[model samples]
Target: MSIEITVSELYDLKETIAAGLLEGLTYPWEALPKIHDFIIDLGESLPKDIYEERGEYIWVAKSAKVAPTACLNGPLIVDEDAEIRHCAFVRGNAIVGKGAVVGNSTELKNVILFNKVQVPHYNYVGDSILGFKAHMGAGSITSNVKSDKTLVVVKGEGISIETGLKKMGAMLGDNVEVGCNSVLNPGTVIGRNTNIYPASMVRGVIPAGSIYKKATEIAGKREGYF
Candidate 1:
């Protein structure tokens, strides 16, 4: 099996409480279904002084900034110093990591956001795992369900893996930058430090440290002081 989309390959597990759960797991998407239960379990162990249990199965850290207009559902945890911006709709089963930003009008469901991840502005992220410091620009959305409603499949060059899930979203690795107005099709797995251009319709697996211009036009990135 390829290591490109694996938990160890795409993420720094030390940045998330799911670290222990991800151990020995090959793929990062394997943690998606278990997020709700994991949050419930982790929420119970959090210090009462730091995190407040809000209604059933919801824990919000005392220092986190949540706008009054934000609609937050249950089985969710907004970690310390996180920001839930205006009008954000979090529809449960989410773990917003520390110092992360769930920005204005963003909608999230059944997702695990690693520490410092930013899904700011008009975004819909569902059934996905975003690695640390990943940022989605304005109007970017993850199209979780296919029109046919069949099980989602992860497709790569010369390989296809069945997920058995009707609703699956994009998996963004650490420091991945998705530009404005982009639509990430279901089962899109972008590797670490990749950048998708604005208004792009992205699908399948994009390798790490790449700049996705189009399906046939991916470029390697050079690191330097710029």
Candidate 2:
């Protein structure tokens, strides 16, 4: 099988607390529904000295910086040294990984952002999983629901996998960089070490280590990039 959009292919599980939850799961989106209960269970086990419970079923690392203007709901865990900027909205069932950044006016729901991921500035991410160090540029967002509201399906080259989810979002692999104002359509899977151009409307599976300029134009990274 091609190593394209599978859980193992898209993420380094060692980077998140949801590692065990993702194990044996063929697709990363499979873990979306399990995130809520998992956070509650995980929060209860965190050391009191390091993680402080804010309201019900919420754990915020002592070292994390959360702006007073930010709104954070339950079933959420903000990891060590992460930053939740002013007016950020975390709508629950979310895990913001160590050293990650949820910047000004960004909204997140039912998502897991691995270590050092950044969704800074005017981003709306829902029902998604962002791998280690993935960065979404300003004004970029994940379009989580289709206008027709049909079950989401992951479409790759010569293959299609039904996700059976009506509210799925994008899955961004490690070190992926999405340019400004881009929109990742539902069931979009961007592979590791790839770069997407600014203001692009992206969908389907983008190969690992590639540079996506447009739907018809994608090129592999330069030899020295690796």
Candidate 3:
């Protein structure tokens, strides 16, 4: 498919504090390895009145609600109005954006969740960049690694990008809605406003404004209701 799923195409830079990190990169996945050092550098600049340094290089916005049971590691930023719920595990190199929700049992690693993004309930997102308002349903997860442990390659019809990274996950564009119990395979990229059906096994680049019923059936939003 001939599509533009670049980082700038998929996300609004205004939605995340990690915008500076992504701005220097072309593809969203390119930001993964840099997230660790980026978070450390960015966290230091955050105003003390707005955000508090909790642990080693971990910044939590005063307006954010983080449950006491949540486990947070270094190089993590929880932005304003974000909610890190009970038993949430933030494994580090993660940014929980403004008004975003990281619900119970959700695990995040090396991910940038843009404003209002929600990965609530039984979700595991790693080495991914979720755009503004993207929402993953309960039990949905991003499978970041290949079984054989080689580099991840983003693939779509007429498109192939060799990422040259062993760990990479889904890239969900703005307002994308991933259905429940779905598994987004490594290097998956869902474009803006796309919706994947429940229990779907999705990989490759799903075009913007499409409804993915299955691997064989992808219909534009105008064709049917989600």
The TM-score leader among the candidates is 2
Q: After superposition, which runs of candidate 1 have C-alpha atoms over 4 Å from their true positions?
A: 1-3, 223-226
lDDT of 1 at 124: 95
Q: Compare candidates 1 and 3 on TM-score and give the better one.
A: 3
Give TM-scores for every candidate, taking all chains together and pairing residue i with residue i.
0.96, 0.98, 0.97
| Clashing pairs counted in every model | 0, 0, 1
lDDT for residue 202 in candidate 3, whole number 0-100: 99
Pairs in clash, predicted candidate 1: none
Question: Residue-wise lDDT of candidate 3 within 1-226, one digit each (tens)?
Answer: 2255799889999999998999968899988999999999999999999999999999999999999999999899999999999999999999999999999999999999999999989999999999999999999999999999999999998889999999999999999999999999999999988989999999999998888999999988874453
Once fitted onto the true fold, the runs of candidate 3 whose alpha carbons sit more than 4 angstroms away are 223-226
The Cα local distance difference test for each model comes to 0.90, 0.94, 0.94
lDDT of 1: 0.90
Which pairs of residues collide in model 3? 1-157
Q: How well is each residue in 102-164 modelled by candidate 1, as lDDT tens digits?
A: 999999999989999999999999999899999999999999999899999999886699988
